[model samples]
Target: DQQVKQNSPSLSVQEGRISILNCDYTNSMFDYFLWYKKYPAEGPTFLISISSIKDKNEDGRFTVFLNKSAKHLSLHIVPSQPGDSAVYFCAALARGYTGNQFYFGTGTSLTVIP
Candidate 1:
């Protein structure tokens, strides 16, 4: 079974509105969470991340919240822009996994409209 999962396959939002993406994980040992964005014909780029110790982490327009008890996390993009439209992926890794292994969710396609 997949350790990480993104329930939503696609979502749309106004350019200036907020875009919310969600993910769930089954492993409690995952101590790090990351959100990545990918565009066509390009590799994924890291958007933001949070450690298990933190309940929330935020960047300029992106924020990630983790609920350890529920094994869920969500990413919020405020003041969304056209450039923010891309496929978003949720990934998790254990605190000290040596193989550099990451459990990744399928991905959520986000469309930001003007």
Candidate 2:
């Protein structure tokens, strides 16, 4: 059972357009949000992240927004480039008594057309 779900399997956008990736979670106990980007044959790399206490976080060209009431989060990449084309995964981190657990979405493949 996936606590996190990515509704869109794929998304395409122009090079100069903004790329918005979305994710939803069923668990309200999660305290952290993380976004990762993966290229073919490579492990997923951390793209950006935000704490549950904050609604928005921005880093360079990437921004992450979290809506606690809706249990939704989104990653925005402004002026998306061809190099930014990759599979994106959003993960929720839950701190439990046993250990920290991470729930990951299925992933959304993003293609930036140049």
Candidate 3:
């Protein structure tokens, strides 16, 4: 059904802790996965991404792990800071579609307590 789902709508963590966000997808054709972070009124910015062929991808403070066989993925942030408070969206791109059609989960708002 091309639905990407974020099970948790929000998450709260204290500063300097690790924050984990989870996502699931029903579509098996999705070969590309991405995580986007957004502030209050701004648009989402790409954080990390992993191709279906790979199991994990990492940036400076963020890491994304994908389990294609299980149709699951997760984003992890280490040493969460107060600035990390924002909405995170999990996105998936279906293979074989020429146009830019990316499916996004509702989103998970992360609050980093100071």
Query: Cα RMSD (Å) per model?
Result: 1.1, 0.5, 1.2
Q: Highest TM-score: give the candidate number.
A: 2
- TM-score each candidate: 0.96, 0.98, 0.94
Worst 10 residues of 1 by lDDT: 93-102
Which pairs clash in model 3? none
Rank candidates, TM-score, best first.
Answer: 2, 1, 3
Q: Put down candidate 3 lDDT per residue, 1-113, tens digits, no spaces.
A: 53999989999999999999999999888889999999987999988899999999989989999998889999999989999999999999976647757999999999999
Worst 10 residues of 3 by lDDT: 93-102
For residues 1-114, could you state the per-residue lDDT of candidate 2 as single tens digits?
Answer: 889999999999999999999999999999999999999999999999999999999999999999999999999999899999999999999998999999999999999999
Instruction: Looking at model 2, report the run of 10 residues with the lowest lDDT sum.
Output: 24-33
Q: Please identify which of the two predictions, 1 or 2, would achieve the higher lDDT against the true structure.
A: 2
The pairs that clash in candidate 2 are none
What's model 1's overall lDDT? 0.96
Candidate 1: pairs in clash: none
Candidate 3 structure, TM-score to reference? 0.94
